[model samples]
Target: MPAHLSYDVVIVGGGHNGLVAAAYLARAGRSVLVLERLGNTGGAAVSARPFEGVDARLSRYSYLVSLLPRKIVRELGLRFAVRKRTVSSYTPLGDGGLLVGEGRTRASLAVLTGGEREYAAWRDFYGMTRRAAERIFPILTEPLLTRDELRAHLDDATAWRTLFEEPIGVAVEERFRHDLVRGVVLTDALIGTFADAHDPSLVQNRCFLYHVIGGGTGDWDVPVGGMGALTDALADTARSAGAEIVTGHEATRVDTDGATAEVAFRTPGGPAVDPTDGTVTARHVLVNASPQALADLLGEERPPAAEGAQLKVNMLLRRLPRLRDASVDPREAFAGTFHVAEGYEQLATAYQEAAAGRLPTAPPSEIYCHSLTDPSILGPDLAGSGHHTLTLFGLHTPARLFAEDNDAVRARLLAATLDQLDQRLAEPIADCLALDAHGRPCVEARTPLDLERDLRLPGGHIFHRDLAFPYATEETGRWGVETAHANVLLCGAGAVRGGGVSGVPGHNAAMAVLGR
Candidate 1:
């Protein structure tokens, strides 16, 4: 083994969470080193111009931000900014569509459901969620709360039943009458989660709770200058706090004694034959990789089976596609999330089909045009040239579907998804696509398999694994990031209350190390 380079703490994986932990720990005067396998640090939260010679920079994998706590940003003094969307979402239905935003909700709800009843119900439903958010969001950064303790903290039995005891589908069905409205509400429960809305397991409820309780506001804003800006700010914060960040160095193994952990890693351009090119010893090790990845590093068995359930597609458009409903402008419809064929029945059908090992006839997906909100993503020449960037999130497309014949399945799925988008547009979306320098349309699609290969996400599960309810289960009063090894802690999305761009897990891991 090479001579050990030591530190007070070593963080595996320099993703946003790892960077957050590094910043907090280093700020407290702990010598910290962060090792990232990728050449860059952002992991899934990154921006890139995939199309050769294109001026448009797209947020490739993880698109929006909602779960990030304001406390982390404020404490870390991160300089990143997230801009709110004036329009929340627009879902096309037949010749008309529902546009929910500032000053548009009432009329859109009336049009979709033919009355003001659904709007009133929508407000009521969100009011309940808001209350739940108030109780839950505050507890995320603290030590884990037992279910009984959490229920007591929640206080209201009705809110507990709605969010914890029952499936989220029940709440949606009981509140909304319109299929489109129900689907819009249900989409929150299904993002990155592969489960039926009505699954008896209440997994959808867990998913829905996290989605709506982000920053206790439930507003998913776009990070200014793409997602990379957020990570850049995190990296800068850590570096400013004296954290050593080493990119292109992948941690290969973690060996720990009762008091210290030693990490073995390989640098870029090193010989592939040898697993360990260097070694680092630390008083504490924070793993920002997935649980399964960490288990592999420890030469232990893998964790429970988890698979990602979304297809991500990115495209640069020459011009925005005209909406079938001419009443609303294309820019308005595209500025916020554009839901395509994601009605309640549509999502259910797609889920059923995908669960049965077949692709949905009409894929359930949503899109948003980043340029409409932040034109800075495009170069000066393309800023005013009618060019825009579109990001799509397709639902119910699990990793298993692409396990065999990935390319063919991805092609068919993409075609179906685009066709579904066409149904709501005045012109074919493909016709509006911009050409890359290679004379090909500027479009890219990523399946679960693709994400696994590129992002090192085991099974491409975005949240690392299915999100657990944010309370403690086995370890009472302990930080959720605690692991079996005394000197090792989980600081990634796999940790409890750990998904999304939220730095709660990272912060808690640092707290554990600091014994605070």
Candidate 2:
């Protein structure tokens, strides 16, 4: 083997976590190198142009931004490029029913529900939880370990009593008279959690707590241009700070010998015999892929067995959807996301079928129209006119797609969605445009088996290190960050403190590396 290219740190995968880690490590004056398998950066946070010439921001797998710390963006000087968006979501019921809320509008529930008693009930539940968020946000951003430190912060007798010992359903039902209204508020309970929304688990309420805790209340925003721009900004920041990035370099194995580690990856243009052409050795290694990705590199010795998993489906629409309501002005077509599931029973049914490894026939889906917000997404010229694009995310498909026929599932999902929208909007499909050269429409399915088989998460569970109820503790969500191998750290969605584009896990892990 040729000589190893030594560095102070080697970050595998250039996703936000890896990029954040690289930036911090480089900022600390440690030599850092980031290896990415794809030509573009940002794993799930990436944006792609599904249609040529005409650009559409494909948040691809992960859509929307919540739980991201404003402090981290500031500290890292990430604000210059990050385009923040406030949320204006409307959950539409099949009839003319709708649940609308904007930017921490829990205070304005009366307006949202039109003076309904249900609005007051939700205000109480959200009010109490939002208050808890104010207290919890600061703690989550910082790293914690000491019992006294954890206790002095989270040991709030009052906060604990309200958060843990309460019937959340009753509390929520009291807030809104409309079951649909209460359902919309509660649906956020499982953004990345594997729990049911109505589950009596205090973790359900905590999901809401964590989202608003970061003080990023309101509609979801993108980082200008597209989701890829967020990664571009991070990449630019890393490179400007003197960090090195090598794309199309896939790390096959991470060889560790107690004290030091070496990463072996194949160089795209290099010879089959020269795998070492791209190999690098480092004092520290950070694994940013799913836990299963780490297990693939580290083997069963770490992560050891299956966890849960999640299925992601992405759709590229030819034209703007035909809504049922023609009276709704086109200008009123906001880029806000719309969640379809309305009540506890609806969510429960979806969850039970999903847990059983079968896709829900009528799945609860969340739809977002990015073109509605930034007409520039269509290009500089189309800024004044409304552009065309749509996104629909369905839940509870088995993580393992190897067994099922993906083509059939995709058609079924698309057909169901069109039918649902048509029934609601009362529109014809002849007006919609399906573009050519966009290549064949395809569906990407990842099953628990895929998460387990490829990502190596336990039982295909994506949160390899869960931080939810029963698993919520100082150590529970910590991932392997503060675990056995002090030099090794886990910094993905599975790690403690939970997932999303928050980048907390990576930021916290970087701090751990610095021993700060």
Candidate 3:
């Protein structure tokens, strides 16, 4: 097929991680080919003009780039731009009032508790655990490991303690002044995990902090134009480095002999014909999509099943929803990201519901207004800018979205969000202009079975296999890239250290390939 074009490496997904790997490999003088499903290359990190003259990043879909290493930015000279913004949270009260919290603020700890004693308790809890992240951040950017290689980084006692002992949540709670702060700090624990926030193996907090500290807490960065530009820069870098990135090519199957693997996919412009059985032989294959997608590609070649799933929803709002503090300007409020957990108890309950496959009544949601962070998104005048988008993550949706009667669930999620906004903003619903659901229209809806059919991940487990359990411990933390497969590497979100914008999968996989 196509004259048997061969390369040293063939990357699937064209997502940020795949792009990162392709760029690095190409720079090292290896020939590479990057395949993407969407017309655009960026996987989740994409931008589109939803309305005329008003551009909003699908920012809410997968916002922020904290886990992305600053060193990689400099080394690649990847023209991606990021504005350092703080992280803030507001819980709207029914009384047209708001409660605010910050990463390192005493005021934030106060918001989490009802009194001084709890605040002191929370402060201590947060301080001790903050060290957990500090200790692990520098280590994630390195290569994956073998058991012996992993042990080289850990002293015997630390290794033993991490494996057989230590509870992640309780360990974190011991450092914070308020339960809410502990929940937020521990929130990272559930990003791709199925465990309860307060579950045992407290060292998981260290894993959470590892990702947080990699980007530095409170330093949320915004792409200059939209998230799409970041992906664009990556694509440009890959192209400049001599990698061929072909979009609109949907991979159907990965045929493998005992030694080499070949990807089969379809190019666009046909009358819905089955995928062409083309093949690319490579010394190494890097999958940048979710683990669930990869599992499907392998068919019976599944990794041990990992529980839990990632559900994302995007909404186009008539206007920004009002929150607890009406006095806080929307611009200042939008400077950082926001979440919808009133306190620790509420957050814990939400996480539990997600694990149970029930949509939490008061689902924990992330609200990001990219237009506020990057002026380019808004028109010449920002106010009354009817065009805006809000991405809700950590949202608990039913296991099935396409099933009949799912509208009831959607309505409930919408109503709860609207009620919260009305109470928080002191604003009326009449002011809202347009509405769209990303799940129904953008992601799960448009790309039905995409996570399963293409990426081969389980239940669209977007964060990769569960790493917080076995991967987070001291003994295994150093095993960032080594998987059980030979010549087969772990180069997705679930790779050691797990998830976020860090590009560690691709970076670490590259090191493994280069034997660096």
Give every collision pair in model 1. Answer: none
Give the range where candidate 3 is weakest over 10 consecutive residues by summed lDDT. Answer: 439-448
Assess candidate 1 and give its lDDT: 0.90
Per-residue accuracy of model 3 over 1-516 as CA lDDT, tens digit each: 233456787787887888888888899998888878777787766676553433344553357677787777777788878876654554433432222445445554344454466556555544443443344455666644444544454434442343325665555554554545555556555554545654664534434545445553424577777777777888899899988988877766665653567777777666877545566777777767655556667674666754334345555555665544655666555455555554567767766775666667675655566655565654443335555555545443433542344446556555565454455455653355453333222222211123444344455555655554323335342345554444445577766655666777788777777777
- The digit string of per-residue lDDT tens for model 2 on 274-343 reads 4444567887888777666777787655555433434454444455654544433323433565666545
lDDT of 1 by residue, 1-516 (tens): 222399999999989899999999999999999999988998888889999998888899988889888889999999988888999999998889899899999999998888999999998888888888888898898888899999999888878998899898988898888999999999999988988989998888888999999878788998889998889999999999999998888899999985988898997675655444888899999999899988988888998978998899999999999988999999999999999999999899999999999998899999998888888889988888889999999999999999889999999999999999998999999999999998999999999999999987878889989888888897523888887788889999999888888888889999999998
Highest-lDDT candidate: 1
In model 3, what lDDT does residue 136 have? 42
TM-score of candidate 2 relative to the true fold: 0.83
lDDT of each candidate versus the true structure: 0.90, 0.60, 0.58
Q: Given candidate 3, what's the lDDT at residue 430?
A: 35
- Minimum summed lDDT over a 10-residue window in model 1 is located at 267-276
